[model samples]
Target: MTVLATPHPTGHPGYSETLPREPESAAVARRLVRTALAAWGLEEHIDDAMVVITELVSNAVEYGRLASIRVVVTRPAKHRVRLGVVDRSRTVPMMRTDSNGDRIRGRGLVLVDSLTERWGTDLHQWGKQVWGELKCEPPR
Candidate 1:
């Protein structure tokens, strides 16, 4: 039962939640992301948000070494939406792909990078936050 908040400028809308570091957190994250984004009428972005949520949360659950997981959703004016996840691990962040013939278990951030307009990380107490942004607008 953790309440999360985000600072937004004008014309910004968002939602965030925190859950225990339990195995079911992933499922809960998926559901929460879908429900939150449904109001925006962006099912595609919602789906992507779900996937990104799973990956980010999974990483945190697996390696966060924290007590809970934090997730955020923001619609910053227009059709721009941002999804973020935070945990208690300060290992920075990295995205690896099988194409490099390296290990074979880290592709979460890779998918996020391909699907979101912008994605990055931020350091917090004991851990870091990973965020992905999606823009619903005409082609640039």
Candidate 2:
């Protein structure tokens, strides 16, 4: 159920790409984001964003199927950028914790939740979009 639709309209601009649901593509995407962030002078958040992107894509590749996954990067403005990875799956993801309250494997979301000011998933008539907003807060 891969789809072709216009991405969200933002002020700064954005780009979309259909990536093969594979581990290798995640690295390539990370590099792309890193480069873009560098140019945006937001390199500091690049790695964290990449990590979350990788996790999101990896999860989609592993669990979500029967649809093409799309990565939408929106540079709304300086000091902020939004990344969304969309899929066909309707299963809403969550930040799960184990019995001991020690998460060994489901930490992808825990990390994502902690890093960004806010993040969420988009599931509409089209598909599911996992998105996060990165704030360009300078280091203390």
Candidate 3:
């Protein structure tokens, strides 16, 4: 795995790791999120971020093509952290629901939706990036 930690163009620290697209990679992705959040003093978001990253990585590993996927953690604003998983698959994730309006197999996304301020997918020519944002007041 290749890990990179640097300042984003917005001047906030960003961390990224490229890992093999396997189920075990979810654990590594969670650690990466934890490390980045801790460095930014955003420990409050760590648990939600872990769950978010795990689901994203799991989906990528299950459905994505190519040998690897990228996990990214970035602070786009002082109090908002964005977590993303990039994969070489163009297939967009859809939240699954049954006729009774109950969540079906895609409960992961449901949990993500409930925990995040907002979440969505960014499509690119090469692939897609699914991301979630967690927000809180900066520590005083």
Best model number under lDDT: 3
Q: List all candidate RMSDs to the true structure.
A: 3.9, 4.7, 2.6
lDDT of 1 by residue, 1-140 (tens): 54343444213336678888776988887877786666556676666778778877877788777688888777765667777788888887788755766656677789889888888988866678888887765233
Q: Is candidate 2 or candidate 3 better by TM-score?
A: 3
User: Which regions of candidate 1 fall more than 4 Å away from where they truly are?
Assistant: 2-13, 98-104, 137-140
lDDT of 3 at 52: 91
Cα deviation of 52, candidate 3, in Å? 0.6
| Higher-scoring candidate on TM-score, 1 or 2 | 1
C-alpha lDDT of candidate 1 relative to the true structure: 0.74
**lDDT of candidate 2 vs native?**
0.71
Against the hidden reference, what TM-scores do the models get?
A: 0.79, 0.79, 0.89
C-alpha RMSD of candidate 2: 4.7
Ranking by lDDT: 3, 1, 2
CA lDDT of every candidate: 0.74, 0.71, 0.85
By descending TM-score, how would the candidates be arranged? 3, 1, 2
lDDT of 3 by residue, 1-140 (tens): 66677644233338888899999999999999998888777778788889999988988998899999999988888778889999999999986554435535456888788889999999999999999999855467
